[model samples]
Target: MNDDMRRLVRVQEIMVVIDALQEKIASNPAEVARLEKDLLAAQKDADADRARVSELSKDRRRLEMDLMGIESKISKYQSQLLEVKTNKEYQAMLHEIETCKTERAALDEKILLEMEESEKRSAALRSMEEMLERKRRETSQGKTRLDAEAQDLMRQVGALESERTEIMAGIAPAYLQPFIKVARQRKGLALVAVRDERCGGCHVRVMPKLIQQVRRATGLIACDSCKRFLYVPDEPSRAAGAGAESPAQ
Candidate 1:
């Protein structure tokens, strides 16, 4: 390939590198964000579980207090039993004691049921605590991995950038802007090879005149169909950048 084709090919490679770097940065940021969301959801679950337990405990205490008050009333009624003198009064006291005992039976059962439910709630809370702990650890691990990868990518970018600057110096400065514009529009694929008389960018047959001009390599040439710079590679089909076949006869 001639100098013009070579320049375009180098520019294409640099754009590819930059795009890959952008994707790497985007991917890591997304991972970090996803991990943070996981941690937040787990924490919310733990909070809700704790709140449920707290509410149940308060309810249990209230039931116990009511039971105690009922018992005290029964005690008062019992003390009154001995002080009664008439048969009618004694019978009335006996009825009142029976009624108190029935009410106490129901209240005691309710307290027992609440205690059982409270135990289950405590178990659920423990499960939530465990889940929250695990989620936090996972979130931390994800961030650590991202940080390490980011550092490595930065180092690679630094080395590649130095190489890219050197390559850019070899080409005329006037060619650079059109190169960047084409690369951006074409998904980092500004340059393509013409093989088998087809425009590699569009896989379309090129006009005889266009192919004639491309072979000269005097300046950048764009495919009419895809508007990408073209060169004739030695092979029928080949990838561009960092590799090539010697131009065919």
Candidate 2:
């Protein structure tokens, strides 16, 4: 390849690398978002557990208060038993006392159950909080690593872009303009090597005459099918005469 062709190849190479780096850089935000989303989900779960623990605590307090009221009623009923005058009145007072004890026993059972559940839920909440803390730490570390990686990629792209600019300056407009136009049209692929008498970009058969012209390296020559500039490899065997066919238009 001539100097212009070599520069074009190098520029394409640099641009391809730059494109890949920029793509990775672009994806950094989405990766960060995904990490944050996971952390947020864990936080939400921890919050729900805390709310449940609070609710259980409230229920336990309410049950304890109800139990206290029942105990007071039982004490009042016992004191009234001493004031009864007749045996029939005494029996009625005893019945009231027995009814109060039954209600008190039921309340005690409910309070016990509530306290047990509260203990269990509180334990679960503690465990969830520990997990949330760990997740937060991991998310922070991951974000930092991604940020560092994106910054590194940006620096590499900046360097490659500078190299591409220098290479572009060395190339004349006649060659540079076509390369730019074709690279834009073909996603940064404006030049390809001829292999097996085929256009490397399109894989279409290349005319023998055009292959000869590409081997001569006289001027910029594009593939008829894909419009990408073609070149022959710097090998003696491959650069041998293709045929004496008429030159391509």
Candidate 3:
């Protein structure tokens, strides 16, 4: 192909790479958001476990206080039994003492159950906290890696853009302007190789005359169907023949 066509092809190739890198950069934010969401869910689970443990502890304390109050009542009733003046009064005092003891026993059972539950919940909380810590570390590392990758992608795009600029400088305006217009209209694909007598962009067959003109590489040629610049790739055998002839010259 001619020098101008070669430069155009190089610019298109560079643009394709830049577009892919930019696409990856654009998707980074969504990936970061997903990481944050997982970490947040873990945090919420740990917080809920901590709250449940606290509630169990509070219940245990309340049950213990009730048990103490019942013990105090029983102690007062027992002391009065010694001063009773009649059998009926003494029996009544004994009954009151028995009722207090029963109440105290029920309170003790409740307190024991509460303590057991609190211990179980506390253990679960510890496990949850450890998991939360792991998630935090993983999230931090993931975000850091993503950030580094984004920065590297940006650098690659910058370098490719610089190369594209240098290639564009060597192309004439007459060719560059139409290429830019077509590339804009065709999603940055203004140039395509003609293969098997077909337009690579549109996959439509080209006339013999147009195919001949493209093979000659004499001027800018466009596919009739897609309006994209078309070029014939140098065949290996033809390139070899040209090389052999050039040595004679």
Candidate 4:
């Protein structure tokens, strides 16, 4: 290959590297959003568990108050027994005392049940809290890992831009606009190889004469089907170059 074709090959390699870097950069927002969604779910679950435990606590308190009121009525009935004068009055007081005792028994049962439920709820809430905490820790760790990945990708983008600037300086000005236009259309893949006597970009078999001319690396050649610049690889590009899909024989 001569001087001009060699420059196009180098430009193509730089463009491929830039493509991979851009792809990495483009995915960062989605990755961060996925992590945030997980954390949000964990937080929502924790809040629901907390509200359930609070409701149980309120129910337990209400039951305790009911039990206390029953006990007070029993005390008042017992005191009224002492103040009774006739047998009828005494009998009436006894009836009142029995009714209070029945009400007190029912209240005691309700209190016991509420207490048991509250205990179970409290335990479940504690477990949920622990799970939420673990998720928060994992979120922190994921953010750290994502930051490192983003930074690494940023470095690659910077390096690619620098490499692009250096490449732009070396290539002919007349070729730059065409190269940029093709690169934009094909995601940094402006130049394609003539492999197996076909245009790698369009997969249409290049004429044998065109291949022979490209192998000589005389001037830029465009594929009829894809309209992309085509070249025949030299010693170095053939050994190390990786590109898009090529045509079958």
Best by TM-score: 3
Steric clash pairs (candidate 2): none
* Per-structure clash totals for the candidates: 1, 0, 0, 0
Query: What local distance difference test score does each model get?
Result: 0.80, 0.87, 0.86, 0.77
Which stretch of 10 consecutive residues in model 1 shows the poorest summed lDDT? 240-249
Model 2 over residues 1-249: C-alpha lDDT tens digits? Answer: 666776787798899999999999999999999999999999999999899889988988888888888888889978988998999999998998898889889988988898899899889989999999999999999999999999999999999999889879988798899899999999999999999999989999999999988877768999999999998765554224322222332
lDDT for model 1 comes to 0.80
Q: Which stretches of candidate 4 lie over 4 Å from their true place?
A: 235-249
Off by over 4 Å in 3: 236-249
> Compared to the true structure, candidate 4 yields what TM-score?
0.86
Residue clash pairs of candidate 3: none
- Report RMSD for candidate 1: 3.2
lDDT of 3 by residue, 1-249 (tens): 766777787788899999999999999999999999999999998888899999888888888888889988998999999999999999999999999988988888888888888889899899889889999999999999999999999999999999899889988888789899999999999999988889999999999899888878767799999899998865666444431232210
lDDT tens digits by residue: candidate 1, 1-249 = 565456557667766786698689779988999899989988988898899889988998998898898899889989999899999999999899889889889989988998898899899889889888988898998899899989888778788778778777777666667777887798878888887789888899998899888877667788999998887753325334333443432
TM for every model, in the order presented, reads: 0.84, 0.91, 0.91, 0.86
Candidate 3: how many backbone clashes?
A: 0
lDDT of 4 by residue, 155-247 (tens): 887887787687678767667778788878877777888888889898999999877776765566778888888877665544344222222
List candidate 1 stretches off by more than 4 Å: 173-178, 184-187, 234-249
Q: Rank the candidates by TM-score, best first.
A: 3, 2, 4, 1
